[model samples]
Target: MAELPLSGLLVLDFSQFLAGPSCALRLADLGADVVKVERPQGGDLCRQLYVADLALDGDSALFHTINRNKRSVAADLKDPADLEAVKRLVARADVMIHNFRPGVMERLGLGFDAVAALNPRLVYGAVSGYGDEGPWRDKPGQDLLVQSLSGFVWLSGNADQGPTPAGVSVTDILTGAHLAQGILAALVRRGVTGRGGRVDVSLMESALDMQFEQLTTFLNTDRAQPRRSAVAHANVHIAAPYGVYQTADGYLALAMTPVDRLAELLDCAALEPFRDRSTWFIERDAIKAVIADHLMTRPTADWLAVLEAAGVWAAEVMTWPRLVEHDAFKALDVTQLIESAGGGTLLTTRCPIRIDGRILTSPRGAPRLGADTAAMLEEPMLDGNARVGE
Candidate 1:
């Protein structure tokens, strides 16, 4: 069979929590051999991140979601024996990932320079809160804090409400993608140079990068930074009649920004009222005001059918259940279910990419703390003796 992209690569995942662990998870998903290094007890802190009822299960949904397809080895770094074991693991790993506060690794004797001396072919990836140096460097940063710091919190959500927490871990997810890219780039560099590289990414950097388009305009112009817009738009300033419209039962989105399209979609006599002058951008806010009042009459379902028939760019609001039940989703059915421990199955969304007509889906299961401890500790001892079962 053909080689998996990262088949021979080995990763030492010293990171816990969302961003760094999720990056390691992606590498594991792509067939890299990833060994997650965890504390001798308790494992990653994310194991306790959710609602309290699941505490009895001894496994967290978050932990399981981001930590599949990897083996786990537990160690107490302060102990000399454990530290020696970790050093041995680092010697064999192609990549090392960590998201500790700035000096924590150095304090633990696993700093990049120290490890790199032992293993020059190691790709060291680190994710942190603010960055290595900044006003918030030593201070802790989480998804909520960074979300508010980045204008994303204000940029999204309804105009009437104060900034609300995004339901998902936006910064962590973005940072994870960046971390993945950095690791992959290092891997590429290592292939050519025959030496590994150190790749450092931060949540703050990734969070700020997420607002590139908004920041570009705001910084260059005297205009006040755009705040909460009721609608989610790719080009918010240019969008008109460009929001979710209510139908009899649900919502149908309208992206009728182009004047001719807007005119036809709204079924109006003329858009002369909107195209008052060259200051149409200025008039857009008020135009939406008028259009909003008109859309108030119809329910979302009715508007959806009308828009669909009219060939207008529109989509019905998809709740979680709605998305699952949507015809396109049902027809395509991208997500799959995997059996878990205790004879239960876990439903999960599938990975997006396809390779030569094949979609790679790894077995999904949570680690049993230090379940791979014996195998990991004996890799060196077993050496040639380490057959598939060993």
Candidate 2:
């Protein structure tokens, strides 16, 4: 087997919660040595941030899912001895990440300037709710709040319904991805210049970036608000036949198919007159209503057979159970089971990226709180002026 891309890299993760830890997790997935720095008392608050009330090995399943393949070290920034140890680790690390509010790091004497002075080749990554100097900088960087603030909530559901945030913490995940991208770019630059740079990402900025297509349209089109169809519209900008409709047995989703072709295929006389492409957006609701009523007359499998035969873009809308059990899903082989140090096991999705046709898989689970503190502190270089991992 080939060695992983980031085998020798060292990452110091001082961030808690989703955004920062997720970035470090990706680094670890690529075989970076990631050490999660957490407060000594309870470690990362996310250890208890249960999703669906699920816990694994005394930590939240969500925490276990994200923090796999990483070690943990406990240190209180307020303690001079512990802070000194962390600074030494930072100096040896190739990458450092944190999601503290604007002045928190500076107050702890580990801001970018201080850390960069100690190690000029350290890539400092930071995540915030908003930009560091904005009016909303002091606000909590929670995913749901960022979604609401960035107008992401208005993008989903029908016209009459209230604002609906996404089912997941999309902003946090996107911000993590952006931070990772920036970190990688900085690493590439550092390879040439031997000087690391700061990479900053904000939840609001990431949330806005996620809607680039629709947001660009809205910005250039007279500032008009997105007009969602009264019926089952998938995207605010897309025309008819771009949503899920209820079939007799299940739901069927349709992508952008020509109205005349669909009318001929489904034998719907009402759809024949809307052959002109210009009316698709304007009469989207009306066209969707007709399509919905017609689709309900047949089972999802029957419509899928016809649509598949007609070369139309359509599929059955499957729930999680059906999706996981499908042959196509199983063929991907994207899930893995990880065992924690305490002997607890969890079945979770693996990293989506593949290198050289090999899926990245590791058996390591999240560390018990401060599990590596003694070993890390006892390293030979930590006691002298030399860097911790040097």
Candidate 3:
């Protein structure tokens, strides 16, 4: 097999929960030798952050899901000896990631400037709930709270419905993605200049970025808040026929389609009066109500077949079980098996990236807390000036 692009790179993951660790997880997936630096006791807080109360080995499934393909070292940064050892490790790492509030790392003596002084080529990535100088910087950076504060909650649900947050931690995940992108760019720059850089991202910024399209419209227009559609609301700024509607058997999602074309295709004359493009936005609720009634007359599959055959962007809204069973999902080959420290396997997703047309897969799962500490501390490189791959 071709060598992964990030082979021989060393990344130290000093963050917990989702944003920082998710960024580190991607680095590991791309073949970086990522090591998690955690507290001697408990390790990543996410080890106990259970979702559906699922677990594998001794850690929550959520922890195993994000933390696979990485090693762990336990150390108390408060202890002088452990802090010195971590500093040595920092000197050798090509990259390091952390999610701490502003000044926390500085208080811990591991801020970007200090670490860059130790390793000039290090790419330091930091994640915060908000930017360091912002008024909201010190607030807790939890995903749900960030989503609520970033104007994201108002974008979903029908007009009559109250503000609704996404079921997933989209802000955390998107912030991680942004951190990874910035880190990658910094690394590219480092390759040219042989100097490291700091990359910072915040959940609030990422949340706003996730709604760039709608936010851009709001900014460029009269600065009036865009109202959610009264019916089948999907996007705050989109017109009718752009949301999920209940069919006889299930839900069907429709994307942008010409109102006239949809009326002819579905054989519904109620949409005929609102066929003009201008009315699509003004009468979106009425047009969607008519479409909803017409769609309820047929099954989702029946409507999907017709809409699909005509090249209209439509699909049956599928549950997880149904989606996993579909041929299209299977064709993607997105799942993989990873083994925990206890030697048991858990099925999870592989890296979505394909380098050299090869899907990245690692059989290794997350390590036990401090599993590699002894080995790491005993390394001869720590006593010498050499780094990994040197």
Please give, for residues 30-146, the per-residue lDDT of candidate 3 as tens digits. 878889999998999999999988899879999998999888899999998999999998998999999978998999999998998999999999999989986787999999998
User: For candidate 2, lDDT tens digit of each residue in 251-358?
Assistant: 999999988789989989989878898988999999999999999998999988899998899999999999999999999998988889889899998888887787
State each model's CA lDDT, in order: 0.74, 0.89, 0.89
Positional deviation of residue 314's Cα in model 2 after best superposition, in angstroms: 0.8
Q: Distance (Å) between predicted and true CA of 54, model 2?
A: 1.6
- Candidate 3 to truth, TM: 0.96
Residue 76 accuracy (lDDT) in model 1: 89
Q: How much lDDT does candidate 3 score? A: 0.89
Estimated TM-score per prediction? Answer: 0.90, 0.96, 0.96
* Tens digits of lDDT, candidate 1, 232-351: 332445556666655456666767556455656666544657754454455555665655565667777666666678777878777888788778888765766644454555566555
Worst 10 residues of 1 by lDDT: 381-390
Q: 68 in model 2: Cα distance from truth in Å?
A: 0.6
